[model samples]
Target chain A: MLSVHRNHPWQAFDKLMRNSMNLGRDLDRMFLNPLTRQRDSFAGWPQFNLWTNDDEIIVTAEVPGLEADQIDVDINNNQLTVSATVEAPELAEGESYQRRERFSGSFERTLRLPFAVDQEKSEARYVDGVLEIRLSKPERDKPRKLSVKAG
Target chain B: MNNSTDLKTTNPPSHELQKQESPTPEGAEPTRETRLYRPHVDILDSADKVTLRVNLPGVNEERTDLTLEKNILTIRGHIDPPHYEGFELVYGEYGVGDFERSFQLTNEIDREGIQASVRNGILTVELPKVKQASKQKITVAAG
Candidate 1:
């Protein structure tokens, strides 16, 4: 006759060890992952949104504390590049920084357009720290209306 | 009787002296008020020019201040904080910190043509490039 239930001490110990190791791994990933990752030069790139309208493609980027002249916009070979250098904040004389969170440096972002753009017709405007770029799509890529005969 | 006399000779309440030195506004009832602080910031290039943006939440465009002194740019503004009397805040989360940020300009910025504007909660500063620093076309002479 076999016992209805059996208690295994080794099984309980093994489960406890597995749970402890899993917790340790989770903590290591949470704390060390970001510190060990390699960051790009343009790590603090501003958030931007790109969308297309009927005849133009619009790109909006959040570039706080930057002037219009500080930014350079170049379009070449169907790609648009936006580059700018932001100077770091100056510390006061004999003042030691306690906590610094703001980021400052040169950054560049290149975006490829879905359709070829008319480089000459592109326009950029900066308002309220937001940069808006409007690029007119090439004439051939624009949608054309076709006439249909009613049968 | 001697103990009571010694207690009276002790230092007067400090609150009384403060009240006398700075009297409250005449006919203005004291009300608890809160104010939000938002810092102004500027972005500039290697040249010492000012490019500023002020984050002024719940503040009108007319109430903000933007100033530039030599190579330093300062932005100052105020926002009305929330008001809730007799309400205990449980699990409160949102509050705005006062804003005060300054930037030192470099020599390349054109200080004369700095432009600024504020709309919504964002302030934008435009620092024009100096004429000599801009890329210019060099003409070739025929040999």
Candidate 2:
């Protein structure tokens, strides 16, 4: 399912104002950002889905032809990040590509969760080129069923 | 390898392009067939064979169809949509849909020797060159 970004109408203007104030500093940061880590702009490669429930949050990404060791997933301060690279296979001598559309590059996506999660308890599995990560909500975050006494 | 052999990448028609090409027929259901997506494909033609690699995540052997008839080769594959119980989507980048691509085979291809396989959601199709065409050698006479 694809959705339009639900950003507040004023958010863009707000960002513009802030960016103008720190233009020089931001330029330096931008130059350094790509050297260290490249971040996705909401919609990026190997598109993923984020799901939330009462007990857990699930994130799934479609990354075909990638080995498990190539992917790195981490969560810190309620933000989950997934990073991976899709490398194009080396071609043999005298072999040239006729059609090249598949992407081959590194990508990183990060999202903040509404509730705290137990990172240690989370489980991840890659099946048929899809990576699914299940992040369980902390014990304190789980909803409690309340019992009512006869009134 | 002959550098003169023409190699072209054909792009599938987008909605706007399709609309420009021809008018939609009357009583045609737009919603039913609006989801036609073109899978990214790469084709490599060597002296002896042509190799095609298509990115088809979540597609397996059971859900894919490959056929060649009358010099038209077609690839059709379906990917099962992922569903989460009681889950509201927070962010999504790609939509889950079926993919279809077709190619017009040339006379140089050995239609009988086509082979296909799927691994890690990557489909590789091999089309061998016709022996007679690749083996033809022009002899130069000394005057």
Candidate 3:
């Protein structure tokens, strides 16, 4: 998508405000939300993309500094879930950060697929901090082109 | 073709501002310059070294560039826009573009000893601290 760049300070401020609001919710989740107090919050770290075609659904997530082993993708009954933990890098002795903006912790993202998928035909690959997963549509869910005979 | 060996850099957009913004006496100058997004970075100051963790998603090792000149460090990289032949985008929130950011280095860093590596879209730069940068212990002599 193409976006027009505008030199408006208020726009940036608006984005900042929105980010702070998200941070407030994150803080709440970090401090207040226990396991029982389940808030249906969709906010999570590392942005992603989801697309679909007639044959399959694909998901791509940008998660830098993570290995493939650290991520877990699961699908069941048209629901897809991705869970991962990004451990903070160990600091050497006397090490301190002037600024630490990158987030580190566990996150779980659950998505509802548009159609049922064949679990056995799915695959995932991780490269250069991008994780791409392909889930093939089930045979029953595939759209069929019917043949018509005219007399 | 999804080749694992081929290095991938995120797509570079043609929309980057061509000229730096400057003041014009007659108010004839363009109102805006190129928009540059600041990449998130972590600067760790340690006794032995200072490390930087920069997030440059979609940028590969081959497309990344790190330079240190006159106590200033700069990082630049390009990312190719993703294209799937048959798929239509259903949902998206992240924007794609090239990444560029620079940092002024302090005197504590050893200019010759800096090292950088890019892995899994994270650029790690280690700047070893000079001997004098470390905290010095002073000895007191009783007179």
Candidate 4:
């Protein structure tokens, strides 16, 4: 006998719930955050990526044409914020832009982690225009293995 | 085909920033092929020269390759993906990969005079326009 494909009802319910939540967010953005041409262009500058290990969480952002001193990184507990403003390039007296696509403006983005981090022990590095922040998980937040006694 | 080679971009409509596909493997182990991305660029035109400014974060001078094959100019930058020991990626807004972009040069461009430089992850290339031969000013006094 051919195995019948099982269709779980929960999966459909989960999808429906997610779709409604997303629709709510879309409505909220349309009403609360008015979409402007300027906002659409640079609102999402410097995309980010996050990684986690047993003891630390790593956050990285691509900030091209910026140095370590140009960008700011701040962390409080489980919240991390990265902000920067790109200076506009100067043009010569007779020169003008034929095609401009790069972004130049100030933007700040904040992220909340699953657990709090140790701010004092955290480290940040800027290399090749990429910013990386390693936030160490606090002692109480890290997982601890409890060995079972032999019976 | 998920050949463990090709990559795709995460952001759907971000045309200004670098666009590359993950092609990032599930783990830290290296994949058989490297992912390629196209960096954003600004073109500046002047009376004598045109300048191209390319955004190439995480790229250095040594890892960049600029070539002009006939009229096609190619810019390639190789970068090592950000990796942390024993860490798993939790969130990703962008992918890391090599940057590759190409532009076509016209006959008016002086290919021999073209020059490029990379600094602070930005690459600038200047292409000079070939000078036109001087026009003769004919005198009609004696004619």
Candidate 5:
């Protein structure tokens, strides 16, 4: 399995292995803003959604402001990876950004499916800045119904 | 052997940008219909024009509408949610919704020359400035 976290000199400092910190955080949140849950769930660039069924698994990702050719998708067994190079918005001559809150840059993410996928039968489409990849489960891994015997 | 380092600065600023969730409007009732979001944006200023680069994914030119009323410029983008029939959503970090936001324009803007276009998933709106918007030197007459 590939890892998103890279090796750093101060990895221990970055990833704090706290034991009893959840109680303090929960207490702080209960007093501060407990009613409204913050939307800041994943601290990543783009967001993705995953759907699964008996036969197929669907993966949809938000790749805003990118062309179809600019995005690359690869699947190795059950692991799927998506990578893209997102460029900054084009400016004609003297225009400079006064305020910017959009995501852009080289992005790569890999997700694992429950079962190995049939790579040959997989299909992907980029529509309205959203990339959707559909992967079908191999015949052996697919669930088969066992008929009930009536004696 | 790197020893001395600034402890305050954990992650040094890089060129990579991160996505922020749309901010909920203050003092407004949350809509019960389709989810609404204020898309992230970038405001660019030039000598003669101010441009706005809006991040509106899942929206195309046909579904986007821009209008100027008085001094406020409104951008409304309609998006259709992905169909989840016969499928179970195992994981979701964000929800799909429409994008709607308004920006107040200054009087110096040349409203006539304002133009907008959409490419990929970004919307670019150019608001040109009027002649009087530039700096002018006033002459003083000694009486």
Candidate 6:
């Protein structure tokens, strides 16, 4: 029994090491795979996060360098869409540019809410380049106190 | 294909301004110039807090500075332009502008515990809620 107990830990360790090696090999294969490489060539799409509370759902999208007026927010049929364009800044004459990494031009993103939202009560705000939208959920979906009766 | 070539051939207004701003050679009159630099930023809400990621390439963490004044969070950094003294730039597309961006913080942010970090040219700022703002419970007793 003592031998079996000792061997159990060793077996677990061996399995963990094998899994680690497999993961490393898989990563290498992914990097070398042609389809994966081609997909990576495209510029990364913008990223966003959504949070839901008892009464509302809030969405925040990372879209730097765009003006609040340039951004458009629309909600229809339970779908929300945010779109904007970042125009290049005016440059000084004769100043040759060495590198330009900032992404300019148009971007659009659409999100679907798990629960239906009350469009009439929704609010949107943009400050310091971050666009935030708060969508109130329907009254029926909100939590309520239910009375209980003793049998 | 046609549009791509057209873009390649014509300089954007910003690029044209940059070229006109270059120092004139001896005996040539200096040209009047105006320059503008704007950094784009977007903020998205996460499960527990708001996550702000700023795209600031060529900006080192050491050179970047962040400050919150009057609810506005300002980020500033200087980037060194590419240097090649002798080689002529040919068919260039990228331009590096000085980085400056600011965001107004709301009451939801936990001012005391806001966190920031930079990795791979991206700056991520995590704005958490204060304890009071995140609280959801209240209790009452029958008289």
DockQ (CA atoms), all models: 0.02, 0.27, 0.31, 0.28, 0.30, 0.02
Higher-scoring candidate on lDDT, 1 or 3: 3
lDDT tens digits by residue: candidate 3, B27-138: 5543334333457777777777889998777788898988888988988767677889989999885666667778899888889899999998889999888886366889
A34, model 2: CA deviation in Å?
23
Q: What is the C-alpha lDDT profile of model 2 across B6-71, one tens digit per residue?
A: 111112222221111123346864344324457777677677888998877778888789988899
How would you class the docking of model 1?
incorrect
TM-score of each: 0.40, 0.69, 0.69, 0.71, 0.72, 0.39
Which prediction has more favorable TM-score, 2 or 4? 4
Chain A TM-score, each candidate = 0.64, 0.64, 0.67, 0.65, 0.65, 0.60
User: What does the lDDT read for residue B107 in candidate 5?
Assistant: 84
Residue B5 shift from truth in candidate 5, angstroms: 12
Give candidate 1's whole-model lDDT: 0.53
Lowest lDDT sum, 10 consecutive residues, model 2 chain B, at B3-12
- Could you give candidate 5's per-residue lDDT for residues A104-149 as a string of tens digits? 4566888878778999999999887888999998888777988999
Model 3 residue A121 CA deviation (Å) reads 1.2
- Predictions in order: lDDT: 0.53, 0.69, 0.71, 0.74, 0.74, 0.57
Worst 10 residues of 6 chain A by lDDT: A36-45
Instruction: List the TM values for chain B, per candidate.
Output: 0.52, 0.69, 0.64, 0.72, 0.74, 0.64
Badly placed stretches (over 4 Å) of model 6 are A1-44, A143-151, B4-143
Better of 1 and 5 by TM-score: 5
True contacts kept of each: 0.02, 0.63, 0.70, 0.68, 0.72, 0.02
Candidate 6 DockQ, CA atoms: 0.02
